[model samples]
Target: MKKKKMISVLLTAVMAAGVLSACSTGQSSTQNGDNAPNTSAGGVTTIEFWAAPNPTQQAFWQTMAKDYEAVNSKVKVNVSAMKESPTSEAGIQAAIAAKSAPTMSENINRGFAAQLSDSKALVPLDTLDGFQDIVKSRSMTNTIEPWRFADSHQYVLPIYSNAMLFGWRLDTLKELGYSEPPKTYSEILELTKKLKAKYGDKKFLWAKADLADPTAWKRWFDFYMLYDAASNGNKFIEGDKFTGVDKAGLDVLTFVDSLRKENGLLARQVTDPFENGVGTFVDVGPWTFTTWAEKYPELKYNVNYTLTMPPVPDDVDPADSKTFADTKGLVIYASATKEQQAAAVDFIKWVYSDAKNDAAWFEQTMLPPARDDLTSNEAFTSILDQHPELKPYAENVPNAIPPMDNAKYNDLQTIIGEQAFNKVVKGGITPDAGWANMKKAIESALK
Candidate 1:
């Protein structure tokens, strides 16, 4: 699971899908809190929680909020739903711009969290009780450095992580003579080629690209994970800094171009694994699996897909097959009342620590848990244990990294993708020329 995301393009898609597509809730234009006193007349705390606009998620979240409210009648929690489909992220910006934001919401990335943190929009949770313990548990088992999340204070908490793993038809692989997933990039390419030759028109594409920036960018990042992270001084982050666009960046884009232009082993930008069935192997996450499992049950049995880490570079450590995980978490807003914020924290903690809370979420959703103790919880172990092919891909998780978050990085990537990536892959220019153009565009953006 390598890290890549196209936020701007996707944001616009959201706009087309209508501002109301993801979730249906009331509209408010400011960070309004509980102006009303408690029923006891002692004190009242109210906060608004903005989150992914998924309708399925609404039930679980609202239930949790209601429970919290029951315990603290003085504390009111309004969980506003905004669909991410058409333009959910925009609502965040729009609400903030209109000065009508909720008390708590989190729209984060490893690189972008700082922007919000610096603006004082997010509260520091470092001083909260059980925060350090939660950090330790998450760090050791998940292999994520908790300190990596630290800003001036604790702006974001570690949430469930998602990664891009190889999904394939298990029976098809065996029919093609690959008893297991390949261990290297070249191996997979070779395997896919053999399968392509056998299937002829029925292809086992490595991946498909989407105009949506995140989907397109993730396809690129997952390809990079097939290489060595430190082979030629590759490191996504150095201490508290982002370190992309060196040999790793070059090697990443080079491989991507090679995959599309040279190999032709991947499906095109518009192929959907669910609708078209044009591809065999696809890159996706757990949520995608859940969607497929539910929305298209007829295709479920056909999807014997599993996870495998991106291959190690030829010269690098064989054991270091890391995954690129870009997932979401909960962050309280600075505007939230202390009691309301505490209530939010309590809801979050219960999910991470209590079995009942964990069960409710798992029953409601198919998310991977953030804590290891909870991995044994029925959600992961059952399906994963039965599907061993998913094991190899699961190895990449501990090493997951977030994609670049700098605003300049975003603009530079867009320019490079438009000028170099799309052009080279679609055969508009020579690879060398495309590389040079990308380099120039990025440098200009930096300046």
Candidate 2:
């Protein structure tokens, strides 16, 4: 998909709900009897669930619901597929406002989850019995830590997690007389210079730089990835302060500016550098590997890789590199009755608690499982054996940092990408000037 399409889709789903109301006081009569939790004549408690619109995902949930119903005959799952759009969350929020929210939501954006948590609209997963131990046994602490907010409450049960990494064509790098990809920003510049010298300036390293489009706010991935490395994993919000626009932020912007002006490494538009063979190296996620395996098998064989963790300055320790982490999972709405909430938790626990089921999810979705122990599961290990390059990405799980959880996350991303990154690269503004504009934009949005 185009960066515009992808960003627009992802953030549109996340922020479409607007601000959730803090007052969950008066119940709305607009909630139809069928929409609310209902007990059948046979005494089965029927609770509704909203599943992602993807056919495979919907099928998976339906199958799970059937299996769960067979096991717990007293609970009936009413699964409904969501509309496929960035504004899917708006529909869910509308249901919630009408006091008809689903007992459980199958897919939730991290930022939106944070908003729900802040508004007290989500049930605390930590309160569930043995939930802590299950999380510890199934997933890495770093991977799970992102869901735990300052209140020490985990609002969502993460199903899978992902991070950004550097992908390259080993053949191209070897032809350039380098055995390995660049490990640092300085090394990247040096390699870019060599590539330009060999193939002309038009054939520079291609990195996405489409900041003007709303959907392309993901362009800020470059900035956050680099800043994480330079800052040694310090978060933008430490306690209650905005620590993003700091020295590390300046360093990242300056480096990006240099990449654009000095090394000719940055692409000013959204282009597939790898498939087109325009870029010898690019930053991407594990999903790209799955895409290559399916559509471009030849390119998949030729590609070498590096996780973009520890993006440190030339003078800093390479071990300190960190990368942005994205986790997707389910959250229960607080509107669910005690019986409905317990049933929802039971379904989640049953699904993830089993090693085989977790591994099966990985096999089907090609997404890494949330639980740590499943890494050794036969199904998951077989996938790694088929594509060993994925091992490095799996190793990056420990270094993965969740995206900023602020309610204004989407707006902040747009500000950074448009006001700061776009200006420095395309408008000829200094990094300092760009940062000042970005800071103002973020502060205004946060308020």
Candidate 3:
């Protein structure tokens, strides 16, 4: 009953050709060893694990694999970075088609996991033994609640949840007679007026090309963050149903339209605008701290800038504001054998059973571990103390919402930018018209 055809259509002709060329050249990330889900001699269950094509991530997984194998002699995990011919997703699709897919892989986001689940490419992680144990041991009960797919099964075990926040130029806000960043739309508009009066059009509220790009993933930083706050974390889409709140969505569009009218937005591409003081505000992630510490050390947190959740509507409570969660997780492939699946779950359980491992993950990756008690737990106190910039992320872990679990998320998110957000920012459409148009287009596409 599996629909492998669905996955086959995911990659375009150009990407598929690249995958084929890479495979022929022995450039594929999957090793030449037997990866067909087989148990080796001595009843050892060998599982291949594809880590994200990142050096830090690959190094972490390789170390973990060696440590895990030392404790559990019956299971062997070969960790390798996934090939990114053009993208890691394409490489995974090629592996599945060639029957060389790893037993499990990390770097699986909720939206992409929905696609994999629809094609029956992933095992329902909730059905696996030790699933609840992992949740309890990792202290991620609340954090993992939103990861359930539409099918009522958990497909991905979330590793990190980057609670996206907005960073404001603290010096700029002080210059505008404010002590902290604005947390509501009305407050932001007032700040915008003061900003324009001071800097004219030379500076913008936000200077980012992604605002006008209409790229699917770009919506995560701009649209989803604000929409989540305005909607009070309402679901935009649920199981092929358009569940977006009309009032909340329109409020977000209207907020953007007002900023555009005030010349507060600069949709053109600008490098390091926030750091260079060309943009007063921009979406901030925990991953950005390391770069800032090295390259733009002058942009100190709470000194030169400060982070806050996305601005909410005037009527919404700013204290309860929510934002998009930039998260990814681990998923076991359905093609794996029963032995391999069991072993994979066992490895995950062992990895998460100790809070020290989570602390190590946080220290090494700088990505906040997906735990509800990140700020409260003593294990993470040292890391947060060392990296104070990440404290806001740890505190707001529960306030971040994961992306919609829809197989058509790519099309759905693109529609949000193309029909509504981009149009409102460009003055091509009224907020009301943009909202109506986007809703119609997205609902039509959902069907």
- TM-score per prediction, in order, is 0.73, 0.87, 0.92
Task: List the candidates ranked by lDDT, beginning with the highest.
Answer: 3, 2, 1
* Candidate 3 residue-pair clash tally: 0
Model 1 deviation from native, Cα RMSD in Å: 6.6
What digit string (tens of lDDT, one per residue) describes model 3 on residues 1-447? 011122222687764565445334432223334443345668888898999877878888888889999999999999999987756777897786575778899998888888677767788999998889999988898889878777789999989999999999999889889998888899899999999999997888988877898878888889999999998888788778899999999999999999998999999978889999999999988878777889998888789899998999999999989889999999998777777889999999999988888888888888898999999999999999988989999998878889899988888888998999998899999999999999999989988
Pitting candidate 2 against candidate 3, the one with the higher lDDT is 3
Model 2 / residue 238 / CA error / Å: 6.1
lDDT of 1: 0.52
Q: What pairs collide in candidate 3?
A: none
Predicted candidate 2 versus true structure: per-residue lDDT over 217-336, tens digit per residue:
465356677777778777765323467737887887787787777656655564666656766666776667667667766775434533345346787788767776655778887867
Candidate 2 segments whose C-alpha is farther than 4 A from its true place: 1-23, 26-43, 209-216, 238-240, 293-295, 302-310, 373-379
lDDT of 1 by residue, 285-332 (tens): 665655565775545432454456555544445466555565555676
Could you tell me which 10 consecutive residues in candidate 3 have the lowest summed lDDT?
Answer: 1-10
Q: Give candidate 3 misplaced runs (Cα > 4 Å).
A: 1-9, 13-38
Cα error, candidate 3, residue 243 (Å): 0.6
